[model samples]
Target chain A: MKTALRPSVALLLIAGILGLVALAFAWAGGWLSPRRIGGAAIADALQDNLGKPEPGWRRAHAKGLCVSGYFDANGTGTALSRAALFPAGRIPVTGRFSLGGGDPLAGDGRNVFHSMALLFRLPDGEQWRMAMDHTPIFPVATPADFVSLQIAGIPDPATHKPDPAKLQAYLAGHPETKAFMDYMKSAPLPSSFANGTYYSINAFRFVDAGGASRAVRWQFEPEAPFAALDKKTLDAQPRDFLFVDALKRLSAGPMRWHMIVVLANPGDRTDNATIPWGAGHRRVDVGTLTLDRAATEAAGDCRDYNFDPLVLPRGVTASDDPLLPARSAAYSASFRRRAIEGPRPDALTQAGEGGAK
Target chain B: MNGPDTLFAFPARLLHWTMAVLILAMLFIGAGMVSTVSAAYPALLAWHRPLGIAILVLALVRLAVRLTHRPPPLPADLPPIQAAAARVSHYLLYALMIAMPLIGWAMQSAGGYPVILWKGVALFPILPHDIVAYGWLRRLHGLLGYAFFLLILGHVGAALVHGLIRRDGVFRSMAGRGG
Candidate 1:
């Protein structure tokens, strides 16, 4: 009886040990955590990326400023409608330029990158937020990996130096970043905004007046493409040179960017921001945005702004791109955190309160 | 084992291990669901929400059982401070297990997203669209998640210390053996 029981006890112990080991692995993978896998950090990074100063705008509202255009019921373009998205007939737009380093204040002016967002209100009294980065494709899909990249790019809090080994390891592991790297290497980091194309890295849905819906990605191509800045030119000028150029444009006249919408196939997942979209899906001209007014930094019109693709108009919806949903969650969480900590008011709440209108 | 009740029961132990396995499986699958960059993956998201709800329900049942069932006493050799710490930690673990899933459900509900526990079974009726509540609940969810991580790390550390450093039967009691 003792011998028989020994085998049974050993078997039970083995099974229990196996089960516990499996469970530990699962929990560590983010199963037991409240935040979804890759959800928390993605949200945090997006908030961090968007919550900075543009030369002209200060964060006035949290969700973002809104921009509205008047269109007849038939959807034919009419004159610019009442700026329902912004209170003063202008939505506060914030722009941020940086090298693609994780640190908020990393001043490697060599590979200049720019991200701009327009927070405006629509005619229907809803808040609209749009954000884009210099590089089109995000480096990694996982929030953990994104956090790792941020840590690698950022200076060590104690030492104030970036870890070269970690950065090299990260770059080596993600070869897909090569396409974006190639683009950055070839493209000029300009004092003027005329050299590079700023892409809406994530895909969005646009509904035409006819009720036809299409997945759209936006790219702002300069009228005349300029060669990328060499290492010598970058070292000569201060990092804020791009801001001065943009300010000059605003001072000169209405600065305009042709908003070209790249049409995506409904069935195509190739060009989703998480993965590369093939060149087969060509972009079509949608409309133009003319920045007629200068942005003021003292007015607090452009602080803590974030871009979520989910914040679209009635005609516009979001695609099933994994990054879009992840971004929506991330942006919402970050905005929420900032709002609670004070200084920045919740955009959605304020928009409802008629702050933007 | 001349001490106050501390060691968990056979049923409690079994439930703990089983729940552990299930929760871990859910996490692994959750990670895979996000990491796998394919169009077919959204179909998998349909599974994650429901599975999370199921885990939440199981956790609640486990908590109820733990509260009702009197566990075996800890080894008399365990100091009062260590025993108190163990009790507090266990309660925290239970709290985290229940809180994590509930917060996630509330966050999704506040976002006006569906909370389908199973394919058709709705856990809670859809929440009225409230952006303020959504924001508050989402932040709470994220904070609680970090808290949960800290608690888990502490629990693991204590267990390792007991098994490796203390060289006591404290680990074996939970390890399910009569020495």
Candidate 2:
């Protein structure tokens, strides 16, 4: 094809050159190695889907209330995990309860996520952070898919709403999304933050004294009874009703949850966050978590925290769930962005006016 | 034109140009990172972390090369003060190149943040976690970053003075052509 080269030889040379260029790009982009999906990309993807990111607010679950308390371990967990908190003592804890959405000003309403994120302060300066949603599992399987879902959810500028056709195409390819949707629609709406079971959907390795590691997932099973949420009552409540309700409930008495760990039976997938382990798996009640006080996020102990799901203790190790690292990176990116953005504007406005706490 | 005696070792020239390009990119990326809350921060940070470590490694090698094989002398007519300034500035550049990455590693360690170069490869924490220490180190890193930029400006000025104005071989020695 060329002036001096045969057709096949020329094609091979072109292909070789193209391949080398691709290799060079891969090396630079970290594709040649186990380069992660960039946290900034995923974080931006989420903010894009969520609309304009609020200054000094989380990119997701922006509206939240912080709580302080302790975890009373009954020693039942020591059989599975050698975490210092599992040694039957009251360990200091800080946590937050939030409604999922990017808008901190969004009202408490239906079809939104309710979540509890915790930081358990163990002995000798070790801390374990856990963020769990009311739902039993993550909506997607991997970090890349999560990013793709966020991109798919980006609003059409002309309509100011996500393109339904794009979402439908995404759902057709990802049955996991359909499964998550089905579960959401069929599952009883949480009546209150205290009433919902907060699940650590991703599997983790619980290492015991003998150095044996067991695949496990856990939930904070609430002491409060569950009841299907009444829609009319929910609609009538104020914008910050969830936070108000949580404070009200706490004022009367300390709220509690039992830390329950579910061990994987043989052949259960520890890597995939979307798959649910069979019901026959053994579960152990590990500890009791008690919340005694509530504080506004503006001045709360949890204010600057980034409740990354991958922050595990010495006894706890991350599983093959790729989303774990993705969560950590994205949360750090979000945290860094807000930290640079400075104090929340509402906090500043309130301070300027000498408003009541 | 650079005489054979004036030119640096071949390896030295290669490392110089390689590091010059990398360090300049690092400065711009660092500036972009703090100036915005955009989603692009993560990608910038990804490149920054690995690139910073690479600069550190290259700086160490370059220093070794310099120590073992002394650079060419300044021109015979050069002022003593100018020569001293060159010596001092070059040392400062090397120190900053080394210190910036070390401080970044320490800051991440103290803050209990991961120094993830890329997926699957994470740099080890060299310091214990202390939030207060992390805050102080972060401030120091920011301050040093500015100082490094200024030092680079002075360097480029010195190089240009020798190359274009004085027509000395100083710049040509490391320019990677007919030295």
Candidate 3:
């Protein structure tokens, strides 16, 4: 037992331990096995109440107007990361702008969450795809909570609308939802998609050239000042008034937004999408996004893309926000369901005619 | 090799004690996290993630120390097979210590989650965003946690045998005190 140890023993021991660790990790990390839990059930639960979308429309952003745009980065983006889209160059962009409700035919005059999804096709042919909502904060912290939120919002057969009591109970149970409710009440509503600021809501890490990383949240703020429609004007507008207004405005001239990236300071909450980092965080105006024209959904370049938040480029990476992975999984499940459902027969024809007009 | 001069260096001993407390706290927090449906779940998750990352960093430092500074040899009176088993178990402990946090990180990253350490400080992802990959990593992280607990039990048992029954200095080399 009185044996002298060699220096080689240390190397062999370290390497052997590391090798075993890698193998164990691979087996556990699913390198050796397939996943059992899927977002399929969560997707089904979310869509169950909404019913199937009209064939040609998206399952989620069913009522959307697509647009083509370009992102002109200020070159200052290099100070943050080496993302190809950041250099002083213009990147072609295709995206959709829509209201939040699942119903394609929901009236524009109704109080609803608005959103946009963008795909910036980089010079290298790869893309940075992102989905953003007008709200500064999401209603829930995790996908499970979101599914529960959706189930709570499902209309009771007897009420023809989600039971107010159920919603109250759900809110009582999930107090994190109060932040979103507060935002809806306090935040200004935009007159058009052209005017509203769209927030990514989730946190992402931006790596600089030195391999150091900073957590960031970005928002697309309109170049035009935010103008809220008064209640009287909102009530005066027609069902498709918002859509028509955006179409006319974009057709007349380019609608522009500043891509504002906010860096998280120490103690900022990055994991909880429902929580907002303080407004005082350091902000960087990375670029301008301009949309010149709006196209009908069927003839649009962005009709097929899912706008997955995880579809990030090399410079930007997702944060451990539970919502990020949940969103990706749910998006996949939604995408599959839509593919299975197929497009409507007359949808393309109608879209063409609409575009021509 | 048999004297107090060979006891663990102060930094090594400090890391060992700190990590032992953290790993145990993490296990309890993790268990509480999975079982809770209350609002406290997120709070637990917030602690669990940062603590896991801290453990990973410290474990790497500890491993480097182990590689550079050879520990005191086992007593000559100890059986050869028992000595070999001791080496093997130490290797297993180190492996679990190093691998557990890393896989947890990879699991979160594969799910397209930022491995937020504290405040806004986040670790770069080791894996790409893939739900299937995330699912696998998650399950693996859970399974390995159980392995970690069992190994700790064995480790503690062996330490007790060296300290209490064998009247050997093996335990004191790391613990710095003999009962």
Candidate 4:
């Protein structure tokens, strides 16, 4: 009995040891698993940190703008005046902006939101894409949400007019859009193009030469303070008031805007576009962007350019934002579709032509 | 007979062959479902959940049988390292078989998605909604899938080496004789 018990006890001990080892291995594997953040986190971090400016922030801001390929050298030694940020560089970019469909020709003086796509071809040839919106936060977070809003806002085919009822219902369904809508409704339209501020809606990783990475958001603030447009002034202005204002500023002396880089806490999700980042995460200015030259229509200055976010520097990488991936897919599909259909000659030519009733 | 003169007993052999056929069928069905796009594709997906549960249940039974029954000893001429490797590989295959289905089920549950094993038959209750947990599980599922693929490749490669290069009866033992 003693001998039989010893063999059985030894077998049980071996099995127990093996089982414990397996459990330990599984536990360690699980603990070492990688964690990924979505696009919403990126957007939040960028928006939360973009209010104040810093010294290194200007170069970083300029880097982002340069990456967007929006700024060019004016040949007068000033780099910002030129319309093309990168003259002969190829960097994929995608841009989306919201404009009132009710009169492509009517200058209602209502505030328009523009999301700029800037893809920069770095010296190392890596592409970095930036999604810059006129407002700090986008109205909607996801493509699905955006599509729903768009569907609700679309005009009836038969009537060729927007259905107010549908629009109201849509807005009611999505109460989360209230903050964005409030900002849009309350923020005064810039009377002059130079007064407008552009924002990076998504958080981006800024890797320094030392390999230290801090999440950042960027803002382009006009040197001149904002002058709000009144109803009388808006009505008096031509339909192309915004475009003309931009062209006039360019035609004048070099246009300069301070580029502000805002630093953010890596883990914070407050400013994630859907939710507003509180005062604690205030933006600090980093640098200045001086536009020294304006491009003529003959030079294809206003031609459609795409900006993609997957373009990053050797050190800089993207956060796994759900919206970022969805946006990337949607932008790629839209850009490919648009490019195949050729440029919108009418919209491009309209700004320079200058016709008034 | 005490048992077959193999690493596996009769019950283990039956379980192994049954699972092998079912899992092979599942892999083929999964590949086909992914490639084919039709109205019936959702219907095919509907079949996956039930089949996966069935496989999971059978794998549990196999594990239980393996724990109770002592498998036949390796060939006396087999090197200690090679025999150890064979045992480890078999254990890994079993571990993966047990894990993959559970991970897939957890992913669906975490995503707030239904995991209907059969028409109106729910094998497990839905997990509470948690985005972070869902993301982690999704990434985990993807990582494990690659590992499973690699292990399968290694297993197949080792089997071929034994059958052809080493000219060992390891493959034939599993393949059965008189074929």
Give all candidates' CA lDDT scores.
0.53, 0.78, 0.73, 0.51
Would you estimate the TM-scores of all the predictions?
0.50, 0.70, 0.60, 0.47
Clash counts for all predictions: 26, 0, 4, 45
lDDT of 2 at A293: 84
Q: What is the lDDT of candidate 4?
A: 0.51
Model 2 root-mean-square deviation = 8.9
Q: What pairs collide in candidate 2?
A: none
Best by lDDT: 2
**Candidate 4 stretches greater than 4 Å from native:** A1-108, A115-117, A209-212, A231-236, A265-267, A282-284, A296-298, A301-304, A348-357, B1-179
Give the per-residue lDDT of model 3 (tens digit) for A248-332: 8887899999999999989998999988887688899999999997876655555555677766667887787888766765664
Which order, best to worst by TM-score?
Answer: 2, 3, 1, 4
| Interface RMSD of the candidates, in order | 9.5, 12.7, 12.8, 20.4
B-chain TM-score, every candidate? 0.77, 0.95, 0.90, 0.81
Q: At residue A241, give the lDDT of candidate 1.
A: 50
Question: How would you encode candidate 2's per-residue C-alpha lDDT over A1-357 as one tens digit per residue?
Answer: 013455455456555654564454345444454434666777788899986778778888888888989999999899898888799889999999988878877778667779999998776556688989998877898777887798888999888899999888989999998899888878888888888999997888999989999999999999988876766576777666667778778878899999999999999998888898969979899889999987777666676677877656668877777777677778867776666665474322333321234
Candidate 3 ranges with C-alpha deviation above 4 Å: A1-37, A51-56, A231-236, A345-357, B1-179
- Stretches of candidate 1 off by over 4 Å are A1-39, A42-110, A141-144, A154-159, A207-213, A222-228, A265-271, A274-282, A340-357, B1-179
Candidate 1 CA-lDDT value: 0.53
DockQ of each two-chain model:
0.08, 0.08, 0.03, 0.03
